[model samples]
Target chain A: MNSSSYYRNNIAAVYIDANALQLEPVQRAISKLTHVRPQTVTSVAEIPAAQRNLRTLYVTSFRGAALSACPGTRVHRCCNYHTVDLYAGCPLGCSYCIMQSYLERSAVTVYADPSPAITAIRAQALAAPEVPLRVGSGETGDSLLLDPLFEITRRYISELADLPNVHFEAKTKTDFVDHLLDLEPKGNAVIGFSVNARQFAVEEGASATLAQRLDAARRAARGGYRVAFHFDPMFRSGSSDGSPAAAAYRDVARRIAAAVDAGRIAWISLGTLRYTPALKAQIKRPYIHDEFVGCADGKFRYIQRERVALYRSVVAALQQYLCPQPPIYLCMESDTVWQRVFGWLPQQINELEALFAGAPLRGESV
Target chain B: MQMERVATLVQRVGPLDIFDQTRLPPDQLIRQGLTAVLALAPLHDSAAGATDAAEAQLLWGGPIVRRAAEIGVGELPARRLGPLGHRDALMLALRMEARAGGYSWSEREAIHRYAGEHRVALDTELSQLVTAAQTFAESMERYLALAPIWRRAVEAGAVDVRTAELCGALPPAVLDTVSGAGRRLSFSNRRLVLTWLSELCGRDGLHEPAAVELAQNVMQSADPLDALRRLRYPRLSAMEDRFAALQRRLTQGTPLELKAPPEFEGAGYEVQLTLRSRDDLARAIEALQRMQEESDELFELL
Candidate 1:
């Protein structure tokens, strides 16, 4: 893990929901991490508007079901992945983040408690033992970027260990796994890192560098946790020689192969850069000028052919460089893309065969 | 914030010609039929141009004054309030005019500019009055910030507010050239050309006439949209053109409508063949056979 903490030095203040102050872990985390005196507030409306951005911290309890399906982009194939919202905002200011468009407030918020989420997962995994539950904690925020400060995700990793068919992956763009290194039984856990080419790293804000993240992957794999990589929002460099984006992704693939045991890699996912209308207005980079066509889900992405080419190049690099191939899937892609890339769609359970013992019928989380 | 000012005193009425008509906001509809004139400064030439409405502080009746000028009607049959503080006068005028049915971008710009200069804080009121998708300050900054020519481009309905704002990011010289080119296009096509030009400038780090020059040089047809789209999406456009050419060659001007998905974003081409008799069926089959013979090339485009 890097020594300088983005969360620790950047957090200007902390506000906890009044009801949540009774939670034991909340007090412990504040004492260990928060430098400023924490404020107790009844609701977010009570906080000053100026203090509602990422510099301020808000610890509130999530009232909805903590565990839910990915709400996969409509008109795209469902990956059957489930997500848990341990936190709702990140300090790492990735330039293209879609969260910028929709989050009503910019403050980094912690859900304060993970007990209900863990309980729900245990019951579901036990009830549907045959279904592979590839649950993640990175839906609304980076899994490990803030995990070290709150130490909430480790509970899921530690408790879900005995569930044979379940994998609790904590995805992060940062190389912060040191705190969880000492847990005796790390469980059925995979430390997933969002990996991208160095060209794309410039816009990812204060996330750990590619080299630092690779080192973290090596550490996690050696620590007996299966690791995964997500090459999402891949860019196209518009050259046959592949000097910029595609070649750089291939180089990243080579670095991953060099960094960890390929057999220990649980999965990899690919997605081209896409932005909603709200996010499109916030972006002012050269990348905003890319040749993108609006998808059926109302998000703009690289035209289908361009995306297929990108996926093919990355998948080929991963297959060629790794001794034992890992399961690779397209994130939020349509059926046409699936057919074009993999020659068939996974129509039923276990059709992906190696990806999972596969997911159950539609609407069921993987 | 609802803007409601107490009814000010209307001391007198004079000839419409004496009241200095041109000093009013451009359209009375914008002022919702101005209730009164807050007479303040006296610069004699308020006859035909924007007199910096804020500095002049003259809120003349909108349509009535224009109608008076048009039909030779005498005297404004309207209220005439005395000079108050500059900000107070603006608040009174805005209160009377804020109930307009709808606001065009240009009208909103004028109202926002006047309100902003006065520091009258009509932002909350303006949000309720207009359907701008951005905050009042945001819209004002983006719209007010555009170069004058680009601003005119917006006023003429050549482009939308959001697209015009993007055009604002163009380097001054490049925007000049693009604005000229965009002037020759229809509203929708004008938007397309400008958007493509902005993106091209960003992609190649080219600015000035050069960025627009590159897109303009792609003009192989009378249609700037066609040429600019080709510039923006080269590979996709080429694929589309090639597929269209192939269909023309194979179908040979018959009613064999073969269409690919929009932007090649989907799979499988659609073939709509119209047939009436066996002879028509025979010709359709012949075209289908020809298509089948070249299916590899056709499907490659898809």
Candidate 2:
């Protein structure tokens, strides 16, 4: 187990589907660490309603599409990345987390067995021998929070190490990559960290400090793995560009540039803080009070002009500080925003730079 | 199966002494004479096995009983249900109150308060008796928590349950400003107004009455919704205003139509020229040439 991994301490109970008990990976992983003994059930659905919350960890076999395409918002440019669903819910209670409105009443379910997901991802990578099939496991949950116990990333990193076109990235806000350091021939596996300015970083409940995450990123980079940074849901620091918050964002950019070699970066994504209609009612954070307006899409974002300005400032700092420019893309942004930031809309997926390019381009056009 | 009738005996009670308007109102006595009101006077089972001369609770037709008292009727016709226990009395009171059918906002507030105080279940035991969805304890608390203006607006059919729930989410200090702004707009506008104002109050950390003066001052605008929106989305609204000014300057009195993306949220800006003749086409070309000069400023809005 990784020294920094805060496993089962937060987990009050462990539940496994009765059928999933037959999987060797589930049985072995359970025997390896978990002090909270597993209780067998007919299914994860059998977990009592009262205990079905973030505190409980339900281990079960993922019965649905383990790997699928990112369902990018309509009218926004999608990164065309795919996600694996080995984990169903997140326990990190970031106030702005979208899952709060959806998974508030459910357990943090971990799909224990990785063979099925590994087989599925390998098939996709083999099927498209040329396309860079970027797949990550943090779409619905933090990638490394409880992963040290289950060693889910090790299975993917080891099995998919030979697939040059398959970039298997494990995205996390935690500083728990110590256990992953021993793996050999790590292939094109990348460890992505979600970074924020100092003030906002504190608000990401239970997430590592910015420095801690950067240190972890440096560690992963040193271990023959590329690293990516996501400056996502960037909270507006000030009305004016010179405000303390805005200044902190640039300093954050400077720090990232200093922390690792520019060549090790896979990609960096920027997104302004936005919310669904449901979050507005339940969220009580101080930053949510900023000036926002409903976009053409149903989500509310910081007014359009403000978002463009923030993106320009952050991208400028990242471009200048890093010796070699990394592929920085705006996540789920309108084409107008893309035009404003990069001066051109990426009509082809390859235009996103090395992060997305080299995928076998079939007759299909993105 | 035949049902057994509930037995009640007719009794004459002192008119002004029956003061429980816990159920029906006193308006029933206006044009109609007193059709006996149901009264409850708990009889002590140990000694005083008879009804006391003290005021009895009017479980039904309180309006008739009170109106009879107002008309100088010395005595009122009433029906007495036998001895009632403490729990049975609470159940009967809440049940009869719900039986009044369509309740006003205050009436729902009142019943819910009584039901909550006595641990009486309104949703389950009285589900059939409840005509309004707002009668449930959880839903009633939402409406009851609203500011008086919003509650009145809700009562007058101006605000909706969802909008009221939105207002309920605001800090207690900001609800006044948000709901006050919402009160003036049309139904849909009321929703937008309240939603924006609440968000503004939350995002800016404007908690105290003094801090929320911008919203309060905006109330004096000729159009409250427009003013509140301008305050809520200062940057977007300012950019929109600036773009309009720029468009006017560039068009220079030509029928040249230029538009930025909706909410300035998209990447494309559009230019249109409605032409009817060759001279119109010439003028349109002239305007297009003019628009080309400041395309940077215009496209910046998009």
Candidate 3:
């Protein structure tokens, strides 16, 4: 770490990779800064074994369960545990990434030093004694993409697996599960993938093919790993005036059931397209755009009436397919959506706990 | 904050139909061609003659004079029909009449329509003014509804304790500001009338000494309206000073205090309660409606 170039801001340390300056445009920006100058350092392998002075940049975030308890839980994804932000930015830039709005620091840089992040995770787990440490590393960044280069996934599995109380969810979109095939699969180590219907997978999401994602999931399941699927950013596509939304939803369900077993699934999360003001602007393209997304009430994603109906249709389809259906939760949705689609409001944490313990829904906490 | 005053004020001024047109007063039906021709032309006798003769008569005599008469209806003979040449004055008088107490139903509808129109200068100050007017109504309503609860606590010989308890029921933003004052008694005594009035109805230019004196007369009370009237003039110089000091200490440069947005408070509260309370869904739903009403009041003000 070059002291002259690197300095700490209030919340985050500013690290300008001098190597990034090799690019002429990037270097020009660095030269424009008055105080700081980039310094060239060795590549990943050449980093010295013992460099005590080098202040490591660690991702410090609340655990999911702890986050769930926070007063502002609805806004935050309190996934019932701490999740790792494996990488900074996603390569697969979907039309509606919430990260675009929330994260001001937009770079595709992975924290090269995983030890500091791992240490932070361990410390967090140690701080909470009785609560099962549920930590994930895919919040700020995609969990996979740089898996082969950084080998962070293998490290996460090997290092965090020993802590029996800790659970790690490796969420990704790319079919990057080869690295995990040989590693001992801990039941706590949940492998997850985000999938939409084929149409969305093809048009909006220009990532791995639907077949490739399904193959990856099946392989993970075969390897005795618990799997989860995120039907996130559920694209609302049809004639502009809203016709045949139910068909689109039915297709989405059929694809999910065909791809993976319901029993092997840990949890399925359904999130409709929600956008913040900034993200909406960032994702707005000049031409070849869907105008419906822009017509929303201030800073809200305006999915059409048919789209909401389609969401309900998709939820219904999933309920019909996934036998002994895995717990379905709507992500970042209003209570109105919950009632209109799910027909019941979400159970409270205690009620959810009771449901978790196989208690009947007593209609008390509707 | 019930916005009862704004509603009352709007009613006194007239109907939504009156404000819908840019022309002030009910009868001054400014010719559409006149407005269009004025936008392009300058002030001159020749330009005035450019309009059709019959249209010119409607513009100058019957409608304009009638409007001038309407505005001068309650004024003394000296100020009556005074400065009829100034359209701005007419607009200001009309605005005052409509928004004196608070937004009337017609004024609410007119303002809403105005906001939707491109002509209205919907800048931040105006936005804040509109928002403050709405929140004032909402906060006062909440305070009034919960008054018995607060009064009970005070009569029990624990004024501070009861105030604290009542404060708990307030939205976080209000509670935070009230708490920072070391005692909400200041809010109850001095700031409440002004702040609440400012929120429910805009300052209404009562900040002017003459205007303040006029309003004091109209309100028929020197005790409460005096403080409320004082807010219109002077423009809260002391509160601004205190706010600056507090900003330096707490927020530094960054905005530490989120303006208690009256719209989302109820939605947020009900959403949380509905999720949390399973058995009393009906009670939660009812509370949600009250919150929605409060939110509706804010929109009405807007």
Q: Which candidate tops DockQ?
A: 1
Give chain B TM-scores in order.
0.64, 0.60, 0.19
Where does candidate 1 clash, by residue pair? A80-A366, A134-A366, A161-A187
The whole-model lDDT of each prediction reads 0.72, 0.72, 0.46
lDDT of 3 by residue, A139-234 (tens): 766686546434666767777776766667788887778768778846467788887766555434546666677788888887877788888766
- How are the candidates ranked when ordered by DockQ, highest leading? 1, 2, 3
| TM-score result, candidate 1 | 0.81
Q: How well is each residue in B141-162 modelled by candidate 1, as lDDT tens digits?
A: 7777877867776777667778
For each of the candidates, the C-alpha root-mean-square deviation to the true structure, in angstroms, is: 6.9, 7.0, 24.8
**Model 1 C-alpha lDDT per residue in residues A43-67, reported as the tens digit of each score:** 8887798898888878987668878
TM-score of 2: 0.76
Single out the weakest 10-residue window by summed lDDT for candidate 3 chain A: A52-61
Off by over 4 Å in 1: A1-4, A238-244, A348-366, B1-101, B104-126, B130-138, B144-157, B172-184, B212-221, B253-255
The estimated TM-scores of all candidates read: 0.81, 0.76, 0.43
Compare the candidates by TM-score and give the number of the best one: 1
Where does candidate 2 chain A have its weakest 10-residue lDDT segment?
A355-364
Per-residue lDDT tens digits for candidate 3, residues B116-140, read 4423433443433433343533333
